[model samples]
Target: MIYLTTFLFMLLAYLFGGLNGAILLCRLKGWPDPRTRGSKNPGTTNILRFHHAQAASAVLIFDLLKGTLPVYLAYFFDYSPVEIGFIGIATCLGHIYPPYFQFKGGKAVATGLGTLLPLGMDMTGLLILTWLFTVAVSGYASLAAIVTALAAPFFVEQIKPEYTTPVIMLSILIVLRHISNIHRLLTGKEKKIVNWKQ
Candidate 1:
């Protein structure tokens, strides 16, 4: 029964993650599907690029909650840190490869950070600052994501060793999802930060 419950929670987490906020919100507003616009990535940045900041903020909050809910539930049920970590991973997988979206989904940046919120705010805050600093300095959101993914597991290892493996898995998954972005960066084709006024 314990195993069954755990599996069920993970499944729920994945389903929640599979709920693409950009896609859904765009649909709600009768706008173009985000997956078909801008960078063709259903994420906050893409929405902000083609749509408005208000829409982008909605997507960000929605994605963050999806990442936070499942893990928080697991923690509330007294699951171990390792179990919670796996649940977090499941949420990220859903975002990256959502079954509802025919296995095409966003890069899981907001959702991945959401999963960490239940574990410790300090780690999450550090990663957020890293992302902000990288984006501010480099003007490449994908670069910031890659750097954050690389840093996440290391931070977990130092503060919560039990969560390291799952965090590492999540990190690898995120980096892999950004492969095209990495290629763009190397080829000097990556999109830089867009001016909010323009």
Candidate 2:
């Protein structure tokens, strides 16, 4: 029954992961599907960049919840660190390649953050700060995500040693999802967010 439960959780997590808020919201608001807009990503940053903040807010909440729920479920069920980690992976992948959206999904940053939020506030807080600070200084959401993901394994390991490997796996997945952005950043061709009010 252990294997069955694990399979079920991961399966449900993957399927739930398939539901993306960006695409759904666009359809409802009659806006162009986010996939066709700036960055062509279904992540919040893309939505906020091309669309208004209200639309992006809805997407962010949904994406964050989707990421948070699965890992929270695994944790609630007393799954081992490794099992939780795998569930986290499934959730992120589902976001990256949601079946409902033709397997074309957003970068897994928010989803990954959602999965980790349940682990503990200490690590999660640090992670958020890192992302925020990076974005504030660099104006590059992709760069912020990459930096935070790379920092995740370290902070998580400090607080929960057993979660080190699994967290590292999650981190790797997040980084891989941002490969295109990384290439653009290196070539000086990436678009950076500018504060209009400034």
Q: Compared with the true structure, what per-residue lDDT tens digits does model 2 show for residues 45-159?
A: 8888877898878888898889999999889889999999899889888888899989999888888889989978998899999999998888888898999999998898789
Candidate 2, overall lDDT?
0.88
TM-score of 1: 0.95
Q: Pick the candidate with the highest lDDT.
A: 1
The model with the greatest TM-score is: 2
TM-score of each: 0.95, 0.95
Give the per-residue lDDT digits (tens) of candidate 1, residues 101-127: 899999999999998887788898889
How does model 2 score by TM-score?
0.95
Clashing pairs in 2: none
Error of 2 at 105 (Å): 0.5
**lDDT, residue 102, candidate 1:** 90
Q: Count backbone clashes in candidate 1.
A: 0
